[model samples]
Target: MAVGVSGDDLMVRVGPDATDEVLGRPGARIFDMTGRPIRGWVVVAGSAVTEDEALGEWIDEGHAFAASLPPK
Candidate 1:
Protein backbone atom coordinates (compact mmCIF):
# COMPACT_ATOMS: atom_id res chain seq x y z
CA MET A 1 0.00 0.00 0.00
CA ALA A 2 2.84 2.31 -0.67
CA VAL A 3 2.03 3.68 -4.09
CA GLY A 4 -0.47 3.20 -6.85
CA VAL A 5 -1.33 4.50 -10.30
CA SER A 6 -4.62 6.22 -10.87
CA GLY A 7 -4.94 7.19 -14.48
CA ASP A 8 -1.89 9.45 -14.92
CA ASP A 9 -1.50 10.37 -11.28
CA LEU A 10 0.68 8.78 -8.64
CA MET A 11 -1.12 7.77 -5.48
CA VAL A 12 0.99 7.94 -2.32
CA ARG A 13 0.12 6.60 1.10
CA VAL A 14 1.74 9.29 3.21
CA GLY A 15 -0.34 8.80 6.36
CA PRO A 16 -2.80 11.27 7.85
CA ASP A 17 -0.20 12.98 9.99
CA ALA A 18 1.73 14.08 6.94
CA THR A 19 -1.24 14.80 4.72
CA ASP A 20 -0.94 18.58 4.97
CA GLU A 21 2.76 18.61 4.26
CA VAL A 22 2.46 16.16 1.39
CA LEU A 23 -0.35 18.19 -0.12
CA GLY A 24 1.82 21.26 0.05
CA ARG A 25 4.33 19.70 -2.29
CA PRO A 26 4.16 20.70 -5.93
CA GLY A 27 1.56 18.79 -7.94
CA ALA A 28 0.22 17.06 -4.83
CA ARG A 29 -3.44 16.79 -3.96
CA ILE A 30 -5.78 14.71 -1.83
CA PHE A 31 -6.84 11.48 -3.49
CA ASP A 32 -10.52 11.42 -4.25
CA MET A 33 -12.27 8.71 -6.21
CA THR A 34 -15.84 9.12 -5.01
CA GLY A 35 -16.19 12.80 -4.11
CA ARG A 36 -14.72 12.33 -0.63
CA PRO A 37 -11.01 12.72 -0.20
CA ILE A 38 -9.23 9.72 1.28
CA ARG A 39 -7.17 10.32 4.37
CA GLY A 40 -3.53 9.27 4.35
CA TRP A 41 -3.41 9.28 0.58
CA VAL A 42 -2.44 11.80 -2.05
CA VAL A 43 -2.45 12.03 -5.81
CA VAL A 44 0.59 13.58 -7.39
CA ALA A 45 0.48 14.88 -10.92
CA GLY A 46 2.28 12.70 -13.43
CA SER A 47 4.32 15.67 -14.57
CA ALA A 48 5.75 16.01 -11.09
CA VAL A 49 7.30 12.58 -11.16
CA THR A 50 9.15 12.60 -14.47
CA GLU A 51 12.48 12.00 -12.78
CA ASP A 52 13.25 8.53 -11.49
CA GLU A 53 14.72 9.93 -8.30
CA ALA A 54 11.65 12.00 -7.62
CA LEU A 55 9.40 9.01 -8.14
CA GLY A 56 11.53 6.93 -5.84
CA GLU A 57 11.41 9.57 -3.14
CA TRP A 58 7.63 9.63 -3.15
CA ILE A 59 7.45 5.87 -3.06
CA ASP A 60 9.87 5.81 -0.17
CA GLU A 61 7.74 8.23 1.76
CA GLY A 62 4.71 6.06 1.11
CA HIS A 63 6.58 2.95 2.24
CA ALA A 64 7.85 4.62 5.35
CA PHE A 65 4.40 5.76 6.32
CA ALA A 66 2.93 2.35 5.69
CA ALA A 67 5.60 0.76 7.81
CA SER A 68 4.70 3.05 10.68
CA LEU A 69 1.17 1.65 10.79
CA PRO A 70 0.22 -1.40 12.83
CA PRO A 71 -0.17 -4.61 10.91
CA LYS A 72 -3.63 -5.98 10.36
Candidate 2:
Protein backbone atom coordinates (compact mmCIF):
# COMPACT_ATOMS: atom_id res chain seq x y z
CA MET A 1 0.00 0.00 0.00
CA ALA A 2 1.00 3.67 -0.40
CA VAL A 3 1.24 6.33 2.32
CA GLY A 4 0.50 9.95 1.47
CA VAL A 5 1.09 12.98 3.66
CA SER A 6 -1.48 15.66 4.23
CA GLY A 7 -0.65 18.89 2.33
CA ASP A 8 2.66 17.33 1.29
CA ASP A 9 3.44 16.18 -2.21
CA LEU A 10 4.95 12.82 -1.34
CA MET A 11 3.89 9.20 -1.04
CA VAL A 12 5.63 5.96 -0.03
CA ARG A 13 4.75 2.34 -0.64
CA VAL A 14 5.98 -0.32 1.76
CA GLY A 15 5.76 -4.06 2.25
CA PRO A 16 2.74 -5.44 4.13
CA ASP A 17 4.89 -6.25 7.14
CA ALA A 18 6.05 -2.65 7.61
CA THR A 19 2.69 -1.02 7.07
CA ASP A 20 1.68 -0.89 10.74
CA GLU A 21 5.00 0.46 12.04
CA VAL A 22 5.35 3.04 9.31
CA LEU A 23 1.81 4.36 9.64
CA GLY A 24 1.69 4.03 13.39
CA ARG A 25 4.29 6.75 13.90
CA PRO A 26 3.42 10.34 14.87
CA GLY A 27 3.11 13.47 12.68
CA ALA A 28 1.56 11.48 9.85
CA ARG A 29 -2.04 11.18 8.76
CA ILE A 30 -3.45 8.12 7.01
CA PHE A 31 -5.94 8.34 4.18
CA ASP A 32 -8.27 5.83 2.68
CA MET A 33 -8.37 4.70 -0.95
CA THR A 34 -10.71 7.62 -1.63
CA GLY A 35 -8.35 10.22 -0.10
CA ARG A 36 -10.42 10.48 3.06
CA PRO A 37 -8.72 10.95 6.41
CA ILE A 38 -8.58 7.92 8.74
CA ARG A 39 -6.73 6.72 11.84
CA GLY A 40 -4.50 3.99 13.29
CA TRP A 41 -1.87 4.18 10.52
CA VAL A 42 1.83 5.20 10.30
CA VAL A 43 4.27 6.99 7.97
CA VAL A 44 7.98 7.10 6.98
CA ALA A 45 10.10 9.11 4.51
CA GLY A 46 13.25 11.20 3.91
CA SER A 47 16.70 10.93 2.27
CA ALA A 48 17.08 7.88 4.46
CA VAL A 49 14.31 6.31 2.39
CA THR A 50 16.98 5.14 -0.06
CA GLU A 51 19.96 6.30 -2.11
CA ASP A 52 17.44 6.48 -5.02
CA GLU A 53 13.66 6.70 -4.73
CA ALA A 54 11.10 6.41 -7.49
CA LEU A 55 8.90 9.37 -8.50
CA GLY A 56 6.01 7.59 -6.77
CA GLU A 57 5.15 4.22 -5.27
CA TRP A 58 2.71 1.73 -6.76
CA ILE A 59 2.13 -1.99 -7.11
CA ASP A 60 3.76 -3.49 -10.22
CA GLU A 61 0.59 -5.22 -11.33
CA GLY A 62 -1.52 -2.11 -10.61
CA HIS A 63 0.75 0.00 -12.75
CA ALA A 64 0.75 -2.46 -15.63
CA PHE A 65 -3.02 -2.75 -15.70
CA ALA A 66 -3.57 1.01 -15.31
CA ALA A 67 -2.25 1.68 -18.80
CA SER A 68 -4.52 -0.85 -20.48
CA LEU A 69 -7.91 0.01 -21.93
CA PRO A 70 -11.00 -0.91 -19.96
CA PRO A 71 -13.09 -3.83 -21.17
CA LYS A 72 -16.22 -3.01 -23.11
Candidate 3:
Protein backbone atom coordinates (compact mmCIF):
# COMPACT_ATOMS: atom_id res chain seq x y z
CA MET A 1 0.00 0.00 0.00
CA ALA A 2 1.10 3.59 -0.70
CA VAL A 3 -0.07 6.96 0.56
CA GLY A 4 0.54 10.35 -0.99
CA VAL A 5 -0.82 13.79 -0.24
CA SER A 6 -0.85 16.70 -2.62
CA GLY A 7 -2.88 19.86 -2.21
CA ASP A 8 -6.53 18.85 -1.76
CA ASP A 9 -6.03 15.56 -3.55
CA LEU A 10 -5.18 12.31 -1.75
CA MET A 11 -3.87 9.21 -3.46
CA VAL A 12 -3.79 5.68 -2.16
CA ARG A 13 -2.66 2.65 -4.15
CA VAL A 14 -5.27 0.15 -2.95
CA GLY A 15 -4.85 -3.05 -4.95
CA PRO A 16 -5.55 -4.85 -8.21
CA ASP A 17 -9.24 -5.11 -7.30
CA ALA A 18 -11.30 -3.35 -4.63
CA THR A 19 -14.96 -4.25 -4.02
CA ASP A 20 -15.75 -2.81 -0.64
CA GLU A 21 -18.24 -0.41 0.87
CA VAL A 22 -17.11 3.18 1.37
CA LEU A 23 -18.72 5.24 4.09
CA GLY A 24 -19.07 8.92 3.34
CA ARG A 25 -21.49 11.78 3.39
CA PRO A 26 -24.21 12.08 0.76
CA GLY A 27 -21.94 14.06 -1.57
CA ALA A 28 -19.19 11.49 -1.65
CA ARG A 29 -18.31 9.24 -4.53
CA ILE A 30 -17.53 5.62 -3.80
CA PHE A 31 -15.47 3.82 -6.38
CA ASP A 32 -16.00 0.19 -7.18
CA MET A 33 -13.44 -2.56 -7.70
CA THR A 34 -12.62 -1.49 -11.25
CA GLY A 35 -11.93 2.07 -10.07
CA ARG A 36 -15.28 3.20 -11.36
CA PRO A 37 -16.80 6.22 -9.70
CA ILE A 38 -19.69 4.81 -7.76
CA ARG A 39 -20.29 8.11 -6.01
CA GLY A 40 -18.84 11.52 -5.45
CA TRP A 41 -15.63 11.85 -3.44
CA VAL A 42 -17.03 13.83 -0.57
CA VAL A 43 -15.20 13.38 2.67
CA VAL A 44 -12.10 11.55 3.84
CA ALA A 45 -13.85 8.30 4.74
CA GLY A 46 -17.26 6.79 4.34
CA SER A 47 -18.29 3.14 4.37
CA ALA A 48 -19.24 2.38 0.79
CA VAL A 49 -21.53 -0.31 1.98
CA THR A 50 -23.22 -1.52 5.08
CA GLU A 51 -21.26 -2.31 8.20
CA ASP A 52 -20.35 -5.93 9.17
CA GLU A 53 -20.37 -6.88 5.51
CA ALA A 54 -17.20 -8.09 3.81
CA LEU A 55 -15.60 -5.01 2.35
CA GLY A 56 -12.89 -4.70 -0.23
CA GLU A 57 -9.49 -3.85 1.19
CA TRP A 58 -9.53 -0.50 -0.54
CA ILE A 59 -12.79 0.50 1.09
CA ASP A 60 -11.52 -0.76 4.42
CA GLU A 61 -8.55 1.53 4.04
CA GLY A 62 -10.92 4.42 3.54
CA HIS A 63 -12.75 3.55 6.71
CA ALA A 64 -9.46 3.22 8.50
CA PHE A 65 -8.54 6.67 7.37
CA ALA A 66 -11.72 8.11 8.85
CA ALA A 67 -11.25 6.18 12.06
CA SER A 68 -7.68 7.31 12.37
CA LEU A 69 -8.60 10.93 12.22
CA PRO A 70 -8.85 13.22 15.29
CA PRO A 71 -12.45 14.16 14.68
CA LYS A 72 -13.69 17.28 12.92
Question: Which candidate achieves the best lDDT against the true structure?
Answer: 1
In terms of lDDT, model 3 sits at 0.39
Point out the worst 10-residue segment of candidate 1 by lDDT.
17-26
* Clash pairs (backbone) in predicted model 1: none
Q: How does each model score on lDDT?
A: 0.93, 0.39, 0.39
For 1-72, candidate 3 gives per-residue lDDT tens digits of: 233333443334333243233342322233343666533232333333234342244356655554555766
lDDT of 3 at 54: 26
TM-score of 3: 0.27
Per-residue CA lDDT of model 2 for 1-72, tens digit only, reads 334443333344444344555464333334454676444333334432333333333333223333343555
* Clash totals in order: 0, 7, 16
Q: What is the lDDT of residue 61 in candidate 3?
A: 61
Poorly placed runs, candidate 2 (over 4 Å): 1-9, 33-72
RMSD of 3: 11.2
What global local distance difference test value does model 1 have?
0.93
lDDT of 1 at 11: 98
Residue 31, model 3, lDDT? 38
What is the number of residue pairs that collide in model 2?
Answer: 7
Q: Which candidate is the best by TM-score?
A: 1
